[model samples]
Target chain A: MQAYRTLTRRELARYFLTSTGYIIIAAVTFLIGFSFVVLLLKLQQDSTLMPVTELFYITPFFWLILLLAPPVITMRLFALEKFSGTFETLMTTPVSDLQVVLAKFTAALIFYVVMWLPLLGCVLIVRHYTSDPAALDAGALGTTFLGIVLLGCLFISLGCCASALTRSQGVAAMLSLMLSVSLFLLSFLAKELPGTSSWQAQALGFFSLVEQMHDFARGIIDTRPMVLYLSLTAFFLFLTLRAVESRRWK
Target chain B: MRNGLMIQVANLTKRYAGHTAVSNISFTVERGEIVGLLGPNGAGKSTTMRILACFLPGTSGTVRIAGLDVFHQSDEVRRRIGYMPENNPLHLDMRVREYLKFRARLKGLSRKQSRGRGDIVMEQCGITDVSRRIIGQLSKGYRQRVGLADALVNEPELLILDEPTIGLDPNQIRSVRQLIKGLAGNHTVLISTHILPEAEMTCNRMVIMYEGRIMAAGTSENLQRLMSNTNQVIAEIAAPLADLNECWAQTAEIQQFDVSPAEGEYFRCALTARNGLDLRPIVYSLARERGWYLRELTLTRYSLEDIYVHVTRPDEEKEEGA
Candidate 1:
């Protein structure tokens, strides 16, 4: 437990000590601000029935931040250690492979949360100007942030697994970007294809992260999507553990 | 720790995809002994040390550290070992004190224990002044000391260092060697090096390896005596070449002799003894009996270099032959 804490602190500090951490925060903040301006202008023109919170998530800018941030945050977790040859020194210590994996995963997840904190600020800004009680629905905002955290867990674990598979940060980042983008696209298959059967649609809906986010933004917190995201997060973490242990045999 | 044995390996072998790195080699290190793993590059010295440190497992062998099985009780084995691998890899972004504290905590020390040990090790390695400095900005020598400090933070019972003096200048090498020697009798050290004089200077005993096999293992004097039987005696005498040859031929102890003209009247004579015998007295009596004017006579026993070359030569020839 102490090893895990120390390692996690070191991993988290690494993100801030280098310019990568601040660059990521800056990029995400800019994208959020841009998405807010565009969404607010569109809402004013169209007089849409969708709530403001729901409109916050479906923007291309929001998806762009979701697609890019985790990879950038996690690419250096294991890959940098290998490139620097600290992986051998770390593994030889009295810590288990599971601890190392969890430390890196948790640190990335925390950084992911910090990156999206600006979105909350933007939402509050909208509430302050409009002064409408309906715009500040507590339940919808809470679920939206919860959904974001769950999704962040899954994406960050995917990035962690990808990072463990290679020693080059560039390769790790590219591989993780490919994995997350493909997963993101898979969530939209049911809606994109016109010839899908009911069962196929149901199955795709069960796995659709976009639908989960929309439901959360509308104050609908179903246990099923929560279960799915949590299980998938666990699954990717398992893959990461196996990838970490694979170094011993090789 | 069985019978004071700090490390024991039996029939250890490591095979990569296409080649065998360490092949059925076995050796042991007792407690508090500073043993050197002397070998040329690619002699499996690092591989052997890695196995002892529990960083990797062998293909089919048993390695016990402090009487604990390396594969089964690896956590216990890891807690007892401080390993500085080849090139001394470190986190370049971390401060010196932070890196050491992290390492100490990772090695199972408590928070308070880690802080105290970190300070002690930093002071011991002479890096306290640079504790606040970022590791990336430090020089190579300071970075190397930081690696050593990380290894020593836990006060481990056995330290496995692979080529600790590699890539250092002479002054740095001497200091690092002195630091390692200072750790003797408190920690069992298994250091590997290819330099003959380094092994002779630091190690109380040496295990020479070649082509994944144990070429020889003993103290310097013991290895010299065990590996060599021929000694040489050089004499500068003013005598005819034929007379010198005849004198050496009459002495049974002289196995071979070489003669070359020195100055105008003196000839340099080198005689090889058959059984490591002292030929200085024999050469002096022979010259005196023959009324030959002798200027100098000295005997040269086998040095560590000669023994090392003698052991590693057959493999070189075999590789060339194949």
Candidate 2:
């Protein structure tokens, strides 16, 4: 428990102390602000009755931020340690592989959440300018942020697994980016197919991030997606633990 | 617990996909003894150390640290061992003091204990001045010292240092040697170095490894005695090389001899005796009787490097023959 805390603390501080962490946050904030400005322009042209926060999720900028931030945030967690040979020093200490994996995963997840905090700022700015509480429905905003957190959990764990598999940060980042892009394509696959009521589409719908976010934006908290995201998060964390343990075999 | 043995290995072997890294090697390190694992590169020294550190698993056999099984009770064993791996990898982004404190915490030290121990180790390693400096910007020698401080922070019973003085200047090497020697009798140290002089200077006993197997294990003097019973005799004489070789070959005490030109009109003859006899007198008298003027004659025992080469050389020849 002490080891886990220390590792997590160190991992978290690394994000704020290094330039890469700030670079990730800066890129993420810029995208979110750009998405906000584009959302306002769309509102002005279409005059849609959509809440600003709900419309924010539909922007390509939001999806792009989600897809790119996790890999950059987690690419160095294990790969950097392996490259610099600190992985050996770390493992030889009195910490279990599970603790190390969980610590890194938690740190990356927290950093992902922090990166997304600027979106809340953008929403607040919308609320302040519109002078209407309904434009930022508290319940919908709550669920939307919850969905974002869940997505971050799964994506960060995937990135952590990728990082643990290799010693190159570039490879880890690329591998996770490919994985996340493929995962995002699942939502596209679900929408492009012919039958919306078919069992295959239903099964695919369960894996769709778009459908989940759509429901979340309208203040729906379905237990099914909640369970799915949490379980997948745990599964990827398990894979990371195994990847870390594989060091012993070599 | 088992007769004060700090480390014990039996029939330990590690086989990768196409090769065996460590092959059925065994050795024991008693408490408070500085044992050096001396070998060339790829001699399986690092592999063996890794297995002992519980960073790598052995294919078969058992490794016990402080009488605890390494594979099964690795966490318990790890608490007692502080390992400084080859190349001394560290988190370069962190300050030295912060890194040491973090390592202490990871090693299960309490907050107060880690702080105190961290300071003491920094002082011990002579890195107190740079404790606030970022490790990435520090000099190599300072970075190496920070690594040492980290290993010592846990106050572990066994210190496994792999090439601790490697890539250091002579002065840095001397200080690090002194630091390691000071650790003896308090913590059992298992250090590895390919430099024979380093082993000779720092270790109480050495396990000489070659090709993933231990070729010899003992004190330097014991290894020297084990390799041969003969001491070498060097004599510089103003004589014909043929006459000198012929005379030395006929001498019963001189088992092997080599003659090379020493200077203008002088040849230097090096001879090994059949027994552990001093050959200086024998060479002097032979030169005096033969009317050859002898300029210098000295009896010198084999050094650690000679003994190391002597033990590891035959296997190379055998492999080439096969």
Candidate 3:
């Protein structure tokens, strides 16, 4: 437990000390703010009723940007160390590979949370402008936040696994970006294909993180998406650990 | 299993794609001893060092460091051993003190303990002045010192330094040598270097490796003594080449002599003398008897370079033959 804490703290310190974390936060905040402004203006022009509903409707588009941003933030977590020769130093230390992977994953998760905080202004603006503010679905908002956190965790773990696959940060980032974008598009492709409704739903569901996003958006706190997100996160995290361990044999 | 041995390896071999990088090799390092792993480029010294550090796993054989099996209990082995790689890859953006503390924490030290250990290691490695400076801005010597500090931050029982003094000036090299010498009784250090004189000055014992195998292992004196048979004597005389060759031939102890042209009317003869024989006195007396002007007569002792060359020469010949 002490080793885990120490590793996590050091990993966090490393993230903040470098410009990578700051740049990521600044980029994510600016995009979220821009999307919020665009949504507000569109709602003013098109909606006759509540702007909050429109804001919630448009927020899924932000996941496109969210999907693209995390690879930039997390792809260098282990890849930079491997390229810069610090991996040898880390490997020679007493810590296990699992500790190193978890610490890195947790640190990136924390940074993701901090990045998400600045975008809360969008929610605040929606609540302020709504006439029936009490009618706002607090449960849906909470579930969306949970879903966003889970998605972030999944993306971060995938990025970590990609980083561990190679020593080049650019290559890692490219691979991670491709993988994340492919998964994002997989659900849409599944929806268009003709099949039995249940099979189609399952196929689309596997690709659509947004299907899980929909449950959260509708104030339905379903356990299935939560399980899916947690399982995917664990699988990628395990791959990262295995990638690090394989270096010894190489 | 020896009582005083700090590290022991038996038939350690590491192969990649069926090509052996480190062949079957074995040696033991005693506690509190400074040993040098001397080899040329691509000699598998780095591979052997990595195996001992547990950074690279050997394909076969056993490595025991401080009584712990390297493969089975690598975490425990890593705790007891510190490794400085050939290329000192450090986080250039980090301050020296912060980097040290980070390494301490990674080695599982507590906050207070990490701070204390970082302080002591910084002082010991003589990087206290640049503790606050970013590592990228520091000089090469200072960077190397910072690397050493990180390696020592865990208070490891064994230190595995791979070409630690590769890029340092004479003065900095001297200071590092002094520091390693100062650590004589506390840390069992294994340093790899191709610089013969540096090894001669710093290491108590030496292991000469060539082509991924241990060619020789012992003290410097022992290596020198082992190659005593190849020792030669150079005699410079102002006499006829024929007379010099005949004179050398007459001596029973002299195996052969090659007379080469020197300055006008002077000849330099290289005489290969028998084992444990001193041909200087005989050459001097022969010059005097023939009324030859003897300019110089000296015995040439075998240096570390000679031993390395002689040891590896056969390997190369066999390679060519195959």
DockQ of predictions, in order shown = 0.69, 0.85, 0.72
Q: For candidate 2, lDDT tens digit of each residue in A133-233?
A: 77778998999999999989989999999999999999999999999899888998999889899988888888898888888877889999999999999
Docking class of 3: medium
Lowest lDDT block of 10, candidate 2 chain B: B224-233
- Residue range B212-308, candidate 2, lDDT tens digits: 9999999987887885676888888998878987898899998899999987999988889887788888887888898999998887777898888
Better of 2 and 3 by lDDT: 2
> How big is the positional error of residue B67 in model 2, measured in Å on the Cα after superposition?
0.9
Q: By descending lDDT, how would the candidates be arranged?
A: 2, 1, 3
Put down candidate 3 lDDT per residue, B11-107, tens digits, no spaces. Answer: 9999988688899999999999999999999889999999999889999999999888998999899998889998789989889999898888878
User: Over the true interface residues, superposed, what is the Cα RMSD of model 2?
Assistant: 0.9
* Global Cα lDDT for candidate 1: 0.89
Q: Which candidate is the best by TM-score?
A: 2
Q: Where in model 2 is the C-alpha error above 4 Å?
A: A197-199, B1-3, B275-282, B319-322
Pairs in steric clash, model 3: none
Candidate 2: residue A160 Cα off by (Å): 0.6
Residue B242, model 2: lDDT of 84
Pick by DockQ: which candidate is best?
Answer: 2
Give per-residue CA lDDT, model 1, range B89-146, as digits (tens).
9988889999999899899999999999999999999999999999999988888899
Where does candidate 1 chain B have its weakest 10-residue lDDT segment? B224-233
